[model samples]
Target: MRKISRGGARQGPGWFARRWTAFWMRFSGPGPVGKLASRLAAWLAPPHMDQISLAYLNRRGYIDATATIYHSDLRLGQNVYLGPGVLVVETKGGGPISLGDRAEIHMHVLFETGRGGYMEIGPETGIHPGCQLKAYVKPIIIGRGVMIAANVALYSYDHGLAPDISICDQPLVAKGPITIQDDAWIGTGAVILSGVTIGEGAVVGAGAVVTKDIPAGGIAAGNPARIIKYRNELKNADKINE
Candidate 1:
């Protein structure tokens, strides 16, 4: 694979492509300008596969010519944008992959599902470039209005850690699925593990390794992701002062 520089790192062209896609997405909603922008985006970056027709996706949204997708069950909603070099591939015993309306999957982002695993992305959710979501034995469900920054990784399965077993021979296992609730913000380089639920309106700081559930409206950072504060806490404090 060819290497590209992004954000002072070796991340691929995801960030650059996302910037353009997002700019175009702004006007892809409703109205005359939106229609024009939608048409322009479709013309410039149509879906690259014969599996999805130009006419079908043109009415929906834009998909970059460089993107590669191969799934037996793939569902895309209105105004969805898939940026450059995005890849969605099915592995062993894969399941369905669904993207809600206005979902934006940026450049070089990868979605891999296997072992009856699946992925469900809600409306208006934006997943930045260089991010990866791999599901196995469970589903990765991301709710509406979620913002996942670049290089974030969500894995719903892990290898067994038995000491006597060889690393390669160990079976895959999962505590549970990964669920990110509505309006959550996941910062760059975050790693979300299996069995984790990030509640609605929560904020996860950059580079955090989340292993547990983050309550709704909570702000969390650091490894294991402890709640630093809750948004309601600030609101309560303001009411007290008043």
Candidate 2:
């Protein structure tokens, strides 16, 4: 038999390496040794036992295995679901990122709050695939029962575009706070800028660029997102301001 090269040996055999990688991936965040550590932590740190479990425990709760959560101060509430390839990243910034209970995020979704970061997402919010939310300056609050469609980007901050300082080099800068009120439905590819509040039960049309506040129970669409119609309807069939 020919001599096995060091490089080839280091990489390992194809099948075994793949299997080993998969197994190691399972134990990556908390690691396989967490089985014992988590148990000990739960014992030693008796108070707030849930904290010990969350810090080290890894369990199957119908969440897609491909999802990735990277952060020390990550808070995932009860029964929250994540689909495949969801990336929740908290890098550089030092603060807790809180996700409310029962928030359903679909495939390829990104929730990134790092480098002057904060995120507070409310309960029962359904975020479809390809949604990206980056809150860098204050906080981004997504209220309860909201539905965010695919390819939607809610950015609470932006970089300064002046020629003196390159945007790539500069850090995230917030115009103001971005808040999505309860029961709002943001359509596909909608972009909600900073310092705006989407009122309760408001509808943001697809491909709209929202720059101002959307009134409660209002329907808005298009670039600069004009409020075209009121959501309420009269018994006689006229559009009523809600």
Candidate 3:
């Protein structure tokens, strides 16, 4: 009978042969032992390339098997979750991309950063599936506890269309940072352009194209989103009636 080697080879065991035999016996069997063997094999097996790359981002975070993260300066906090098909890319010389603790990025979300541009999502923020976030010259900041619905687009740069140059060739321009303050609710299909701030506790309606800042506790909805009501004001009115 051929002796099983330490490295799973068919050869006579040399040094530390007893240790290898004991280790194999502990993890070899049919029921519970089979389960332990499977787990050990998985743990010892080499991870995929994407998994290896994401390990540099955050050891504590959970990245889906289908997610693709290109070479980037990624800083992910503890308990951060990246869903399947999520694509995160950093252009050459782009700034760091950060996701705070408990930030949940849903499936098929795309995050891109251009040269010198950064993107940050604060703690406990949940970005729904199919969202696109791009930062060219300025930062895109999503504050803590923000809830962003599916298919939303947030851009921190706009293309310049000079009559002298083609629109596609025109240099990207940034008015300022795109800031979505804490506890804000962004509805589905909303497009938030650069230089706009969605204030704390504000709500943006679906399909709105936000151009200007929405005040705190304001509710805005439209093609060019306009403040229709303030949540604090509504609460005050309700108290007066009571």
Candidate 4:
């Protein structure tokens, strides 16, 4: 038997873990240390530190802010960072969207699901701002260490209409589960449709609309994403557009 390639498995120097650790370290600093760090972080290049604090509070192993939780029966693990205005909804769903520890969710992201459907996000993953994730009747599993860029839309189920049947009249059915394997990078503005699986280590190009499953280590692009290259094995390695 041959060993299957675990391309999407989280490897390297634990970049995300390091950042999370640093956040805690700063918080545990001297009496005035945490505030100073926040000021400095704000002064530094990038987004504000206040946003980071809210995110850290929402999902951190150090503190469980369960009582302030706006939703009941929603599972949030330790060290999971959820920024301000992060909304998780089970409006018509029977289950919940369980988030793993150390997951970073940016501000203004919307998560909604329908009956018996679920959306599960793994640990140390970054869910960027303005992402809309809707699961209807089919579960969506986002693997560990996944990097989802801003404004990404992911739907695990879609409406179906046969030639003989009217789409508006017939009950909506889920195409299938949408599985985003570990270590995958979903570029900014990328849209992943129903029944699509982004394989391990796969890279989805920005503004691309994925209509099907992308193979492991694959780099896909275009309106309806098409395999353009493979990070693990490909002849045109140097020709990688990215």
Q: Using TM-score, give the best candidate's number.
A: 1
lDDT of 3: 0.79
Number of colliding residue pairs in each model: 0, 0, 0, 8
lDDT of 1 by residue, 1-242 (tens): 75545554534455555455556655553345655564455453434332123323344666655667777887888767777688999987999999998788887999999986999999889999899999999999999999999999999999998999999999999999999999999999999999999999999999999999999999999997899999877865466557
The segments of candidate 1 whose C-alpha lies over 4 angstroms from its true place after superposition are: 1-57, 235-242
Shift in Å, residue 64, candidate 3: 0.3
Tens-digit lDDT track of model 3 for 48-114: 3222323223335556546677845888887676766889998876788899987888879999998
Best candidate, lDDT: 1
**Model 1: how far residue 104 lies from native, Å:** 0.5
- Summarize candidate 4's per-residue lDDT along 119-199 as a digit string, tens digits: 899988988888998888888899999999999999887777778887677766777889999999999999998889999
Specify the poorest-scoring 10-residue window by lDDT in model 1. Answer: 48-57
The TM-score values for the models, in the order shown, are: 0.75, 0.71, 0.73, 0.70
Candidate 3 residue 113 Cα shift, in angstroms, is 0.4
Backbone clash total, candidate 2: 0
